[model samples]
Target: MAEQGAAERGPDGLSRRRLLAASAAGGAVWLLRGTVGPESARAIGTAPVLPGGLVPYQQVYENWAGEIRTSPLWVCAPDSPQQVADLADWAAANGWRLRAQGQRHGWAPFTVAAGTPADTRVLLVDTTRSLTALSLASGFGGAGGRAVRAQTGASLEDLLAFLADQGLGVAACPAPGDLTVGGALAVGGHGTAVPAAGETPRPGQGFGSLSNQVLSLTAVVHDASAGRYVLRTFDRSEADAAAFLVHLGRAFLTEVVLRAAPDTRLRCLSRVDVPATELFAAPGSPAAGGGRTFADFLASTGRVEAIWFAFTDHPWLKTWQPAPDKPLFAHEVSAPYNYPFSDNLPQPVAELAGQLVSGSEQLAPVFGQLQFLITKIGLTGDVTDLLLAPGLLRSLLSGDTLTHLLAGGLRSDLWGASRHLLQYVRPTTLRVTANGYAIHCRRSDVQWVVSRFASSYQQVLATHQARGEYPMNGAAEIRVTGLDDPVACGVPGAQPPLLSALRPHADHPEWDTAVWLDLLTLPGTPGLHAFYREIEQELLGLFDGTRAGLRVEWSKGWAYTTDAAWADPAVLGRTVPATLRAPGAPGWDEAVATLDGYDPARVFGNPFLDALLR
Candidate 1:
């Protein structure tokens, strides 16, 4: 069970018959045959189904976190809706809880409990492989009159690639490429964009969250009599729809329908060694003068992104444009893909320069080992690499250290000797230096988040300076998008009557475009979070609740909590319907009454009717 992915779990834990039956009840259930010896089943209140030989528990569970493992009492991989329905029924009769697991990337224990039958008991519906159906559905009653219907198990990368093949593409997306559709939608994954004018915005809205683009969804609900009911909903229902979009199927998500845009090619440009202070400063301000200001740059380009290196005075900027005008081309640029200090490293660094410019996985191990060394001595690096190959030094530091170094360096350069008295100063300075500059290229619509994160051109220079980190002295691009959907989170006040009403003027196509702010930070530094928070707060203010807010990449460093304990119960109570609420099932009259204001019966429910009713 330890150190395994989903593909490696042992089969000895449960019986196939019991697993199927329990899974029929809508929860992850293990057959007695899979978990215990044939004789031990009696003690657990279930008889063992010994027909197929036992498989070891080690072979069944596969998790990515490496810190925890789970052994479901029953694991069911249902291929179709009917199979899912049947499994729900069986779990209800057997008194087992149901858990729908996808990708298993979550660090929390929401999917499986530890150290009890609860961990191995009940049925777990694995979505990793069961659902692979992907196709274009025409005349789907929505805008554009066409949509892409994806089964719950499809990967986002595959989905985008598939769509692109069909001459279509995702309007926005998160940075990492490996995320799955189900996982993204369930957890409210987001992308970055500036809302168009007249778009109602709110606090904390991030464009990367997938909930904004969902056109429709299908969920399997458990009812009072332990029967499974399928529920469907469209974009119009506000309260229930919003709740469903954010909810990760305490029931089950069977399908997702997304509204996609036509495929288009984008050109990309990059710049390195730019001063961070001048990049993100406010428009027309003195601090942002003598270089392309972030706002002005974004206004001129198709898209813009910026990356700043900590402990150094350079920021990388990238800009992209649609294809045909500029043609597609790949670069040999180096940057972090994940945190610089993550356990997953691409390779070990043999030189100081290699540490600065390599991507995240490649940089983390080097940074950690060197950081340990630096703790004993002082921060050390090759002087030649510091001046001529700063990227190599960046490849070696943890993201926290990098951020600190950059902030410290910026503070030192801007404020001179006065910065030495700060509270967070390091005992020793990083031995790296650089003269930042910009590179020009066309914009790309695909992989906007990645392009922005990696590119050094579009970073917010002023924010870095305010925090004592040197700002990139390059353009920090930003664009705006008009708010269309009322169901989308971050729109202030009640949901809009229709999305089109908020569209920008017809004369300007770019007027209503979503804003993308490119940013960069030093690797292995703790200041990244604070800097991000400040930027988020500022963006939320400038937008003035007229559109969706900023998008923070959760997998990278944004630590979001799924714990309901921290959630505002009143908000939940107001947003979720009484019938859909946990524990007590609503009476038929109550359900009907609840359905009166909103569209009725499209929402799904769980099969434990009596338990829900109680």
Candidate 2:
């Protein structure tokens, strides 16, 4: 998760705090006792050797959050691309489903549904171990430009480390480094970034989500020319290839050649003093949003996020700007995961969590405040040390310091390569469910979008609070990004991501940006389902899909009805498909048809996919 603000609350930041808290509570506590592995092992007998050889299939397969568990018949760790192809062929032929898993950092069940029967004959293909092949070149296969050829199993952390060595980097990536290239691309994972004011868009480099950077991908799709499933490479320009770029795990990906750029230094700064009403004021409203509004920050830097706690006024606003050189207040760091308090649960939050676990769900409200208090106070201390250690006079940082320091509330400036700055979050971040949405609008309309959302969310939370139900335990995280660019893929006429929240909207030709929103909280809170549904209803009512439209983040939880994720038969069956296949969504239908034709057997289909696609 993007710890700068996503704290399990959304893409990353405090949304991650909810996750880290769940994980920190104790790994064993979350696991379903005497379930998952033993049952499967007893039924399946000894695991069988498959095309790529087997790894004994000893452990119970669990998602990163420990939410989903399964006992697979085999854990195939293929050593080469051919082995992966062979396994796919075998799975298709034997009527067995193949679920690919990398870091399993996401909550979505793209690989396998959580409650799939233990007795079912499913094979778990662990790509992170053996399929990690990477290579860098000045000019690569698809675009004849700078690129890196990496196996799907290669983690984003490793990919960036390799790029760092080669003096290259991408526009943006998910906050956590533990994600595999395959998993991140499958759902079109992204970071919050866009072109700054007066800046021209760059060729072969997109300030959009990570999926836009894919020049070409090699996957195990059924080739009509061949009698069985085989390794096939599709250039970004091909209409059918659009589906693979962000197919939500409907297809199996092996490797990709991603566009790259010469690395640049960045300055990441944080501030937590802006009042919510002023920062997210509605259009034409006299809310007197203090200093620079959220839009103003984006106009200058084009990369920023605000983490507004559920019940707190001050948001932990963070802005990352391009800095060619280190500044006096900037801390020089080479690696990521710099926030130790966030990485590990602090004592107070831990104790409160312990209490919450022991039938004190009323403490949920206190939990939210503690999250804000700890982050506010802890981050302030860190920034104070950064400001003080350099002998910068404390009195110089007086009233309205955020105004004079930097337009974005400069608490502390972290100077490092963009990759390092982007990934300071650990994998243990969020194990709880988080709901997310992306609103498509122009950069100028960002505040209107944010304000509308904030006002509505406040009302819903207030309603729940009146009923003594604190469903939201974290921040309603906000982030921004541009629509995915077709040119960056090096496809002569590539299309944008079909399901990307930032996909260019036909009705809003002037709207080139997307506003990401998320509210994070601990799992198992009473009335969480009903609470989430109300928020969903409120967001849908406000955005309304005309000049402003709505879409769900692929990786996080969504389609809430009764605290259950991907529930709501209407949403699962109708809304998602209709939205993704909205008017002007280039090649969306062709992409689906191509995938369907390739996997006529529907081997990748899960209950979620079948329902949505039906």
lDDT by candidate, in order shown: 0.39, 0.71
Best by the lDDT measure: 2
**Residue-wise C-alpha lDDT for candidate 2, range 346-421, written one tens digit per residue:** 4345545544533465666666655555565445653443244222223323344323223332235688987988
Per-prediction TM-score, please? Answer: 0.52, 0.87
Model 1 quality (TM-score): 0.52
Tens-place lDDT per residue, model 1, 1-614, is 12223333323443222222232232233222233432454233443221123221212343332223444345556667556555555555445555666665443344553323533445566676768688886654434424688887787666766776676664345444455677767655544344322332232222334555566667665444534443444442443444445443344567877766555443344454345556655434576566565554554543455544333343445444333332323322112121122112122222322323222223333343343322211212222333343454445554654444333211111111101111111111121111111111112221232233333332443445454443221123333332334434322332221111122222222333344343332322224344444444344344322222233222222221222111233322332122122233222233333332231232222232222212
Models, CA RMSD each: 15.1, 7.3
How close to the true structure is residue 449 of candidate 1, measured as C-alpha lDDT? 24
Off by over 4 Å in 2: 1-22, 25-46, 71-73, 138-145, 201-203, 382-411, 583-587
Error of 1 at 90 (Å): 3.5
Model 2 lDDT-worst window of ten: 5-14
